[model samples]
Target chain A: MRKSTIIVLALFAALFLAGISAGEPERVLDQAIRICLSCIGIG
Target chain B: MMERVRRLVQVVFTFLTNGYWAFPFSRNIYQGPLKAICSPGLNCYSCPASTTYCPIGAIQQLMAGLRMSLEMGQLYLGWYVVGSIGVLGGLFGRMVCGWLCPFGMIQELLHRIPGRKFDAIPGLLRYLKFAVLALMVVALPLFAVDEFGAGDPWFCKYLCPAGTLEAGIPMILLQPDLRHTLGWLYVNKIFFLVLFVVWSVFANRPFCRTTCPLGAFYGLFSRVKMVRLSLDEERCTECRACHQVCPMGVRFNENPVDTNCITCLRCQKACPYGAIHLEAGGVRLGARQSRPAQAQSS
Candidate 1:
């Protein structure tokens, strides 16, 4: 594989691992539970 | 023939993701676990039938939380959102824009309406999406906070026509209570949506080309994405037929993986010599053509 391709793969892997460790799924669940009025431009 | 197939795919996807059938008007926003996963395209989170969250909205929320994280002395980012976008982009690039985005389908259908068509889009305008990503989605949310450490989702609040068309208008129509709360921002967003609708009739994908931050994010992965367009040089005659047919004005003969390309496969169909095809992880996924030795020798 090309060096640049390898670097991109490595970067993606590292970020994915960091995201998994950060409790990203739970955080997303918490946020998704409510509607953000501001996001709809109401607030 | 291929165009018909593309339209069919778009229609099917649109129906599948639309939540109106479930009568979201009477219920609260879906709080399902599926909402944790990010949809591949730019569907609105507030869309009642939306099975997953919009990645752009998710990212903005994460950015808004940055102020709180700073005060708490701990880093809190929407890792799932980031990871989903990264993984999806790395795998498919902007194919999501072509094949999956509900808004993209709307724009495409709207563009089909008979009107004066525009061909040239200024090169500078293409860079506007990246600027939006940097300033509206990232910068404003991170810096433009209030006394309570809560920040505005600038892009979603001020700019996103998807949120306006898909979530804003529908919600207001469904709930009479929301109609009373409408303000200048709502009017401004409706005006923006109207302008985009008119613009799409004249120009091809004005939003995808110029303003969509999700497209900008996915575009960053175009060069390295797992699913990619490959050109067989031997069969290519450099006729520029593909370029002529490309809705996004991509010069496919020169750069098959141009960031502007949404991978609608229009170029592949336009290639008379059958020089272009899609590949995933080095395995060809579609029709493969070999240049006849006689033709090559001639």
Candidate 2:
């Protein structure tokens, strides 16, 4: 309800849309689909 | 009722996020369509059954490839993960930590094993998670690139107990070939994993309080999060009942918007008066109505 909270929420929502349009989630997916060797303490 | 519902939600989220049923047969992690979405909680992507990616792990991976991503003319390198986290954080803040985090549920369950319990951890240690989010999650992955122009997921490799428990142990147990690769790194990770597991039995959410980078990241939005706790100072009796029930050591009467608060609302349940309320997007969810004192947890 406050101005600052509304601003912060709107800002993040915009960033989310931009990120999606830029195909950034696909970039994240490329790494995530594989078994992260370092995450499992290997490689 | 709130506590019981929280536990059920935690269980459901844990199952839904890690519901890939082919792991036992394939002896490998799920590489499915759901991997693209980053879950708000701290479930390891490398876990054989995990359907969604862990947000911290995804961000670190993106940051680690900053050099390569830029070289490939990728203008938006880490915005997806950052924005996703921001959206979730701005909505509920550390409510993800309290309700959806499988690791948080594990820690809480461990603490309930009926042993000599400590009220809280050292207050100074509470700041360590912030340092971890800055250093291990952000700074190291962005700046500490290798000769080949790629960095490492430093936190996952060196410090994440969730990864060790959910991914490393299971993968090694299933593959068996991975056992040959086990060395000091695995031993070191296991040490911290065991340390936190035992520590959780004696204290409430020690890892969340002192070391979880994801919790720290969400905590940043506590002040602005749509879903939050509001304290009616005039009606509050200063009885310290809220403090007694807070699993994360947040004293709501003193500071309703404390960064460490998970917005679990146990404090609201504990209060004798209707001084605390849960608000979501300016709408009162609950906690204003008076309840019997017997409903409060000891």
Per-prediction DockQ scores? 0.56, 0.76
For residues B45-149, what per-residue lDDT tens digits would candidate 1 score against the true structure? Answer: 887666678888888888888778668865567666777788778777898888888899899888899878996789999999999999999999988989988
Please, what are the lDDT tens digits per residue for candidate 2 over residues B1-298?
Answer: 9899999999999999999988989999999889998888999999999999998998889889889888988865677788888889989999999999999999999999996898578889999999999999999998999898999999998999999999999999889888899899999989999999999999999999999999999999988999998887767778899988999999889988899999888988887877899888888885357544643332
- Model 1 in CAPRI terms: which quality? medium
Q: What are the RMSD figures for all models against the true structure?
A: 2.4, 2.9
CA-based DockQ, model 1: 0.56
10 residues in a row with least lDDT, candidate 1 chain B: B19-28
| TM-scores for candidates 1 onward, in order | 0.91, 0.96
lDDT of 1 by residue, A1-43 (tens): 3355557766776776787687776776677656667767798
* Winning model by DockQ: 2
Q: Rate the local accuracy (lDDT) of all candidates.
A: 0.81, 0.89
Ten-residue region with minimum lDDT total, candidate 2 chain B: B289-298
Colliding residue pairs in candidate 2:
none
lDDT digits (tens) for residues A1-43 of candidate 2: 8777888878888888888988888888888889988898876
Best by TM-score: 2
